[model samples]
Target chain A: MRRAGVVALNTFREAVRDRVLYNLVFFALLMMAAAVAVGQISIGIEQTVIVSLGLSAISLIGLLISVFIGVALVSKEMDKRTLHALLANPVRRWEFLLGKFAGLVLTLAVNTAAMALGLLLVMIYVKHSLERSDAVVLVAVYFILLKLALIVALALLFSCFTTPLLAILFTVGFYIVGLYVQELRNLPVEVMSPAMTAFTKGLSYLLPNFENFNVMAMAAHGRAVPGALILQNTVYTVVYCTIVLTAAAAVFSRRNLK
Target chain B: MPGLAIEIENLTKEYPFGFLHLKKKTSLEGLNMQVETGEVFGFIGPNGAGKSTTIKLLMRLIFPTAGSARILGKPISDVEMHRDIGYLPEQPYFYDYLTAAELLDYFARFHDLTAADRKERVERMLKKVGLETARKIQLRKYSKGMLQRVGLAQAILHDPKIVILDEPMSGLDPVGRREVRDIILELKREGKTVMFSTHILSDAEMLCDRVGVIVGGKLRGVGAPGTLVDMKTQGMEILFELRGTSNAPLLSKATRTGDCYRLQVAEEELYAAIDQLRAAGARILSVAQVKATLEEFFTNLVEADGTHTSAVEVSGK
Candidate 1:
């Protein structure tokens, strides 16, 4: 566990020194500033516009960072031959994989928190006063983070067995499919063959249900998220990420690394 | 077995290529070798001769297709055994975003070093590898030689009993190579077992206590550098200066340049030739014996393998 922490800290240092978080955070803040400008032009619903645009910007930027960086997490080490020296140490292969996952999650968390804070500051600047319901925005930001963590795990799993470019495609593909998994689960059985219906149903359960974590609409409306839904999303993300990371470790441990 | 630092038995690695990895290419074939404690063992081979593959298998960076290996009486599969082992891969690449000190400190943490120990060790290792001046600079801006020095520093940061390096002298200038050579010698003096692979036979001849010459995915020879080559005297060359030309039959065959005649003769004929030259009043300058070298032995092994396989194919056909 200590060795894994070492690798994790080194990975975090690499991301920060590479200046990846800075560029993404700068752009996210810029988008929130734009949202504030757009909010001023609207006669009413200015808070709604800012809330919706700001949350969307945060989520979109977080997704971009998670998917792009997550896909390269393992592949970059292998490509650069850094894994050679690192794995040669006493550290276990699974530990290294776990460390990489945790490190990227940390980066995402920090990036998300920065963007979330920016969104709140933008809100305060425009509203000239704070609202009691404004606290729900933090909940919305937390949901986005949960969604990004799941995406990072998916990207890491793809990275373990495939090239970075292919990993990115697969992760994004799964995310796109995952967003509409409810529709797949509800496809009309009357028009479909029995096997097709069964296949779609199976895939709907197998793929992550990202829609469960979407709370931007609820937050924008200044409504409280149900405690039950929060519990479910948290549990779901944990279970899904554990399984995906375990699969990644298994694949990585047996890989030839040639 | 008690004194052995590494032991290998029938180690093999066959890489699968082609569509769906159906075709197999043998990178290493049933390699069996050992390195004793506190000796510098050189793994010498030409390109694609399985030297790096063998090292990688020993380091557990890659799994073997067949056979097993043990280090310090523990199986290669034992992660704990790695605590006593340090490895540097060929043309090692590190996280270039890290400075030299940070890189070493990060690696030192893997050994479970205390904070104070890590700081002290990182500084000492940087100085050991002659990177103290550039320890603060990120590796991305380092030269190839400087990066190689950092690779060396990280490998030995934990002060492992056995150090395995693949091509440790590569990508270095002459002075850098000499410094690395001195470090290896220093490690040996400290009673640390060192195993390194290189294609540069001269370096092996200079540093290795014993060398294993690998060729075509096979070990062609293994022994002390001098013992691996033919020790029998091939011939004797005598250099002499004659005041005037003589009709001595041996002297007539001698090649003359700058008032010196050089004559090469069989060991049996050396004395007779010397006697005849003396009779001709020739002044002997020097006498030396010619013997096969490690370089020649290495080249012959490579060429012999090529021809030997081709001959077998022709004969079978």
Candidate 2:
């Protein structure tokens, strides 16, 4: 456990120093600034529109950052042959994988916190006041963090078998596809035979309904978010992230690094 | 056998490539060798001779297609053996953004060293490799020689029982090479098994207790350099300086004869061979048998292989 923590810390430091992290920060800041402009065109929900757009920007940029950075973790190590140093030591492969994932998640958390603070400042400046329930911005940030954690796991798993570029592409593709699980489920089963319908339904059940966890539209309209719904979304995100993480660990355990 | 640092039996690696293009090549054929504890073993080979592949196999960076390699009598597939080994690859790379101290400390932690212990070990290793003064400098600013020195320091920092170095002296100049050589000797003095792969025969000739020559993925020879160079052939000859005149007849009578060369035994023989000597040796110096040098032995091996390689190849081009 101590060794894993060390590896994690090393990975975190490496990731934090990556140029890509700076670019993500810049993009997040741009989005927070853009929310101010987006607030002027709001139909009615001035503060709501600003906060929702800011939350969406954070989530989207966080997804890109996680996928982009996470996929390259193993490939970059292999490319530079730094992995040899790690392998020559007592570090386990599973430990290395977990450490990278944890480190990246930490980066995302830090990035999310920054975005949330930026959005909060903007909301206060634009409205001259803030809603007490605007703490849901924190909710939105937590949800985005959880979702990015899952993306990190996906990127890591793909990294074991593919190049960094391909891993990122596949991971981002999966993220986009995961969001359309509702549409995939709402497809016309009557047109298809029972077998095809069952297949489609099975895939829908298997893929995460990223849409289900999206409370941006409701939060933007000032609808009350029940504790039960947050709980369900949190549980789903945790379970999905765990499943992907386990798969990544399995693949990495057998990964051959030369 | 119990003290053997590494043991291998028919280890092999076959990398499959070009599945879509309908071609594939096996990188490593069946290779078998072993190194004992506290030995400075040299794995010498030409380029693409499976030296790096063998190191990779022993490190378990890749799974073998067949056979087994054991470290400390435990299969290398076991994670426990890693703590006992340190490896320096041919191209040792690090995060360029990190200072040398940070990189060393980061690696030290993987072995569960405490902060104080890691600092001490890192400092000791850095100083031993002469990188302590530059510890705060980012690795990107380091020269190739400095990078190699840093690599050496990290590889030996934990004082592993076995240290595997692949072409560790490739980019070093004379001074750097000597420093690394001294470090390797020091490791051997401390009873650590040091197995390093190299194409430079001089390094092996000077540093190795046993050297294995590999070519085209086969173990051509394995033994001390002196023994390998001495095992091939032997020859003897004699020369005489007469008082006033040519002693052709007397010399022929005293010298040995064989089908390869015959002794000239008369004035007539001298007269006939005089023209040959005039054409070959304008001034005849004293002739004597000279024992073949190690250089000659190595050249003979490469020449005998029938590749028609140039002299540079023999000199590790």
Candidate 3:
């Protein structure tokens, strides 16, 4: 575990030094500024517009950062041959895999927090006072972070076995499919055969249900997220990330690395 | 066995290829060898002769399909045994974003070194590798030779008992190569076991206590560099300057270059040739015996293996 921390710290340092976080955070802030400008043109719904736009900006930028950087995490190491010297040390393969996952998630969390802070400052400037409803925006940002963490896990799992380009495609594919998993579950059973229904139902259960993490609508309407949903999202993200990361470690351990 | 630093028995590795990995290619086959403690062992081979493959398997960067190896009596699967082992891969590429100091410090943390110990060791290693001046610069900005130096620095930062290096002298200038050779010698003087792989035969001849010649996914020979080749004299060569050129007896057989003539004679004919040259009033410049070299021995092994394919052939395949 201590070795994992060392690898994680080095990985986080790599991302920070690469200046990837800076570009994405700057873009998110720019979008929030644009939201502020758009808020002024609207009448009596400035908070709603700002909350909706700010959270959307955070989610979009977070998704991009998560998917791109996460996929490169292991593949780039192997491509650059950095893993050759690293694994020669006493570090376990699973520890290295988990460390990379944790490092990217830490980067995402930092970027999301920076973007969320920018959103809060925008709210303060426009409203001239802090409102209790604005606290819900923080919860919505937290949920977006959970979604990004899940994406990082998926990207890492794909990265273990495929090229970065294919990993990116697979991660985005899973994310898009995962968003519509509830619809897949609710397909009309009257029109479909029993086998098709069972297949779709199994897929719905197997795929990550990302829809559950969407709290932006509730935040834009200034409605508080229920406590139960927050608990569910936290547990779901933990369990899902564990399974994906375990599979990643297993694949990476057996890889030839030639 | 108690004095052995490394031991291998029937170790083999096969890589799967083709669609769905149904077809397999053998990369290393039935390798068995051992290195005594405190001895410098050189693994010499040509390109694609399984030198790097064997080293990678020992480092656990890849797994073997058959057999097993042990380092310091611990099986290769024992992770704890790695603490006493240091490895540098061929053409080692480090995290380019990190400075030399930062990279060494990061690697040291894995050895559980404390802050002060890491700082001291990082500084010492940088100086040892002659990269102290460039320690603060990021690896991306470093030249290949400088990067090789950094690779060496990181490998020995923890001061392990055994060091395994694959092509450590690659990308180094002549002076850099000499410096690395000195480092390896110094490590041996300190009673550390060092195993390095190289295609450069002269380096092996100079520094290795013993060498293993590998070809065609198999080890062909293992012995001391001096004993691996034929010790019998191949012939004798004499360099002489005929004073006044009085039609020396062997002058017709000698090759002339400006002021000197050189002749090769069988070992039994050496003294007779010298007496004849003296009778002809010739001044002998030097006399030397020619012997078979490690390079010739290594080439013979490669040829005997019948797998010495050209680079173009390998690439096309």
Candidate 4:
């Protein structure tokens, strides 16, 4: 447990210093800026347009950062032979894996909060006021964090056996496929063969339901976010993240450090 | 009981290719060796000679196909046993964003240490490796030698009983090498067992109390460096400038027929021959007995093709 904390802290420091983190932050900021400019050229629902676009942009950038950095974490350590040093110590493989995930998650949390605050401030300035229920923005931010947690877990699983580039590609591809899983299931059964329907249904259940966590869009339009729905999405993200992280730990334990 | 720091009996590790491949390559074959408590053992080999392979096996970084290794009489894979070992790899890596102190602090948590104890140990180690001045600077700017020193510091921070260093001196300058040598000697002085792998034979000669040399996935030799050098083919090159207008002593030893001296000593007499020359009125100029270095010994063993055991014999009886 102590070893995991140490590893996590070191990983967090290493991740925060990466130039890629800054680039993502910059791009996320630019996205909000673009959303604000587009809102000015808008038809009536300018506040709704700006908030929805800004939140979506932040979430997308956060997802990208989490997957890209998490996938590279283990592979980069192996590439530089640092994993050998860590393994040589009185540390367990599971501890190392958990520590890496924790560190990446902590970094994502900080970046997500910064991005959220940036969008919230712009929203407040535009309306000369912020909505009372705008406080629910925290829930949307939390949901986005949960989603990134799942992405980090998936990226870590890929990193266990593959190169950084391949891991990143597979993780992002999984995210895109996972986002469209609902649409994939809604396709006509008559138009698709039995095997295709089964495979697509299996994929839908296997992949994370990112659409279920789309509270940010509803919140931006001032729509009510049901408490039960947030609870359900949180439970789903937790279970999914747990499974992926466990699989990553299992595979990493068997890898040869040398 | 004060068990051996490391013990391996008939340890073999085989790596099999996939279904498409026909042969399996055994990386370590029937390796047997033991390092007693408080002994400095050197592991030496050429590149791709299975040095790292053996270390990885010892650390349980990879599962062995067969055989077993014990550390302090416990199985190599025993998690609790690792608390007694400290390892410094060839190129020790640290998070570049952290300072020397932070890096050690991060590693210190692995062992059972209080917050106060960790802090004290981290400071002490930084001082020990001569990095106290740079303790606050980010590791990104550290030179290779500095990086190595910090690596050494982290390895020993927990004060492990057995220190395993793989190619620890590979990138050190002469002064840095000497400093590391002093640290190794200090560890030995503290009664800690120190094992390090190095291709530099001279360092092995200076540092190891016992050494095991491996080549082609087999242990070629295991003993004190001095003992191995003595057993290998080393001779005395005596330069005798005859004290003369006459080439009498030179010619007499040469059988008076040839320009070369017919040295008739047996292999054991080589040392005595040089002593006798110094005793005789011959040479008096320079009498130097050249001993085979560990490098030459290792080269001979690797190139000797498993059957030849020709010992270099001196010819002056």
Which model scores highest in lDDT?
Answer: 3
* Per-residue lDDT over B146-186 for candidate 3, one digit per residue giving the tens place of the 0 to 100 score: 98998898888899999999999999999999999999999
Which residue runs of candidate 4 sit more than 4 Å off their true CA positions?
Answer: A19-39, A193-196, B15-23, B233-239, B243-290, B305-317
Top candidate by DockQ: 3
DockQ of all candidates, in order? Answer: 0.83, 0.69, 0.85, 0.65
Docking class for model 4 is: medium
lDDT against true structure, model 1:
0.87
TM-score for chain A in each prediction: 0.96, 0.90, 0.96, 0.90
User: lDDT tens digits, residues A52-72, model 2?
Assistant: 678777887787778877888
Instruction: Write one digit per residue (lDDT tens) for candidate 1, span B1-317.
Output: 33999999999888776779897777778999999999999999877788888999998888999999999889999998888988888998898888899888888888888999999999999999899999999899999999889989988899999999999999999999999999899999999999999988889999999999888778888899989876533788999999866889897778989789999999899999999999989999999986778998888787878744532332232
- Candidates ranked by lDDT: 3, 1, 4, 2
Candidate 1 vs candidate 2, TM-score winner: 1
lDDT of 4 by residue, B5-65 (tens): 8998888876655586566666777889898899889998766566777788888777777
TM-score of chain B taken alone, every candidate? 0.90, 0.79, 0.90, 0.83
- Candidate 2 chain B: 10-residue stretch with minimal lDDT: B308-317
Candidate 1's error at A143, in angstroms? 1.1
Put down candidate 2 lDDT per residue, B221-298, tens digits, no spaces: 778778887676354332333333343433444443231233333333554454454443323333333455545666
Model 2 native-contact share:
0.84
Candidate 2 segments whose C-alpha is farther than 4 A from its true place: A19-44, B20-24, B236-317
Superposed by TM-score, candidate 4 places the C-alpha of residue A140 at a distance from the truth, in angstroms, of 2.7
Question: Ten residues in a row with the worst lDDT in model 4 chain B?
Answer: B308-317
